[model samples]
Target: MAFKEGFVWGTATASYQIEGAVHEGGRGESVWDEFCRMKGKITDGDNGDFACDSYHRYSEDVQLMKQIGIKAYRFSISWSRILPNGTGEINMEGVNYYNNLINELIENGIEPYVTLFHWDYPMELQYKGGWLNSESPYWFENYAAICSRLFSDRVKYWVTSNESQCYIGFGYGTGWHAPGLELPINQVVRAWHHNLKGLGLAAKAIRQNAKGEVKVGLVSCGEVGIPASDSEADLQAARNVLFDRERSEDSIDFGFGDLFEPAIKGEYPKSLIPYLPKGWQEDMKDICVPLDYIGINVYIGSIVEACEDKKYRNLKLPVGIGKTSMEWSFKPETLYWVTRFISERYNLPVYITENGMANNDWVSTDGKINDTQREDYMNQYLSALSKSIDDGADVRGYFYWSLLDNFEWAYGYAKRFGLVYVDYSNYSRKLKQSALRYKRIIETNGEILI
Candidate 1:
């Protein structure tokens, strides 16, 4: 595992997914807070009321990071917590909470990689049309500006948005998330433009408030479209599997109604732009502003080539391939190609910020979680990653999906992707087998053999 100097070894977590002080510390309501309140929207009618209590347990978490020999920590800041009303007023206490966190991370020798937004939209903003509103970009920039002024001093890396395609597409189309309004076809197109524009605008704002060479990364998730076999029929199917969330036909707006469009082409396939309110091209140019690097979140690759030949879009893929406890395909080879695809298409350096597997490792009688599945999965993927880097992929760093088992969003606590096993019943955390193995990997700089 020989590698160049300055490699980043870190763990990642989102604020809403972990921090449980939802209503405490002058925090305003977020869409997630509101969404979970709806009956049955979550797996077990569960809300993130006391999620790992990371808000109070961050010191312990940071200690866990140092114990694991990690050099960096990438986490998001809760929006509503900072701006309780979503605008017009700032909470000094909320700002103090984050300042304390950031300063503490730096003092403890951990680089802080902060994400401004991670799908936890302030509930107040949702009342005014959420992402669907054209003014959302202004709202986002305002939030970014405030964050920059406070923590930009210590933070060098900032990610503007986390997986725009997933949050926008799933939240609106699938009705799985907040601001639970399903809009008309044309409106959905507006939201897409607004989100991309808002992302770019946030970056611009952060740059304006920066005092140093602050770097920004945009996070997007993907699955490789694979063909069932080498036959031309199957191979062709692989080329057009556009059902991935980003490429999907689900939209409240008309333009991106096409199931999927290739990024290289530079034009969405929906062909509904005739209905736009005009100036969409300008907005897109803003959205395409230069980014220092793109953060890619890859779980597994899919066989797109398998779905094309059949009619009715009824591609019968199996329920199982390579799976974690969450049953997501854990193919790192897909990560290699997808990194190649986005880098070649956008011609930008990339970082994998979220990549890990979940396991059904039960607690042994001695109160230890021996998660060999997770350990093996990490090795398999990292090996593929090594191959990717060797093959000339411009990947700088890789942050494991998480540091510990915390609340898993809508999935509740059912799925665990942590290297450390957490006991929710008693709020106790124990390092699992994978954590021990990973510590050695980090300490040895990934030199340990598979």
Candidate 2:
């Protein structure tokens, strides 16, 4: 079955991953910039100091998207770029850069879905205690107000933040990403509390400040367990893992509860209540503020089943399943289960915000990227998404994880998850085979997947 009419077809990109003019446009340092400088941290010791150079080449990127028949483009704004100090005076140059990119997408008939923040927290704010401080929510709301007022006239879809799980958990818990801080549980919960509150305040600020009617949402993803079999007990097991705890304690530290529980149930997971910082419950009102939809960035899935002990247990993946270059298991059916579960549980329209596989992709000697694996991956996952749509899932849209090969956080530029191959040496973009295939899918509104 083809996707319903008006289903948005787009590509997703983050500011720090794609935009490379980090020092230009009056941009200040971000936590990522500082973190990347630490020795023995990032793989290949590489940083996003000069990523795909999308900061200067977004016009060309938008042209590529238009040529690919995408109806929309989702990109992020770097908070530090807009407010170099993370608060106070605005950076007009940074504003102008986004204005240019947004205008280009609009001119090309590509709807713009803007994410207010995608982990590029301003360094000044990190020094001011980052998300652990009580004032972080207000600071974020202020930033949201600025963005809503400036870009709302042209952009109609606003995502308050993208993947709080990664920024909070990896950045603070595992010290794997930016602002690397391995804090105790209470401090981590403190940061988590501020982020959820920030999301609500940002949504409220955008609704009140944006120039046009807008849809505001938050993006979240952690460990999502899909039932190994569709039995009542197995389905219940999946639901338990989705809300209770992830596969392990380390995985649980990734904010599976902080991101999903509060947004859906207006409270932290019961298991995590013991670690709650003081006054955490009081912030539930703002954290549970109304959102037009929920965006989920799904790639991998864990399998779960009900045991004889009347408890759910996470089942290990069977050996020898297909895996991506990043070693992520290729489980397309994950889309079907995730969308259905989120829609049924949260009663909110679901958007597949980020879904793509990292491949060992390269422009071959003939200057062609014959990434058949990626092409098949897109086909299978999107087919599953179509199945979800048919099964009463209020699934709204699907956006490929990336438009261009970019700096993949701590993995640096080693992992490539893009439809367009970026020659890191010179910042050239070549559309891969999957990109052409995706163009056809978009042109036919996903009939190609059928």
Error of 1 at 132 (Å): 1.1
Give the per-residue Cα lDDT of candidate 2 at 55: 89
* Steric clashes per prediction: 11, 0
- For all candidates in order, the CA lDDT equals 0.75, 0.87
After TM-score superposition, the amount by which residue 223's alpha carbon in candidate 1 deviates from its true location, in angstroms, is 2.4
Give candidate 1's error at residue 415 in angstroms: 1.1
Q: Model 1, stretches more than 4 Å misplaced?
A: 227-277, 306-320
Worst 10 residues of 2 by lDDT: 246-255
Give me the overall lDDT of model 2.
Answer: 0.87
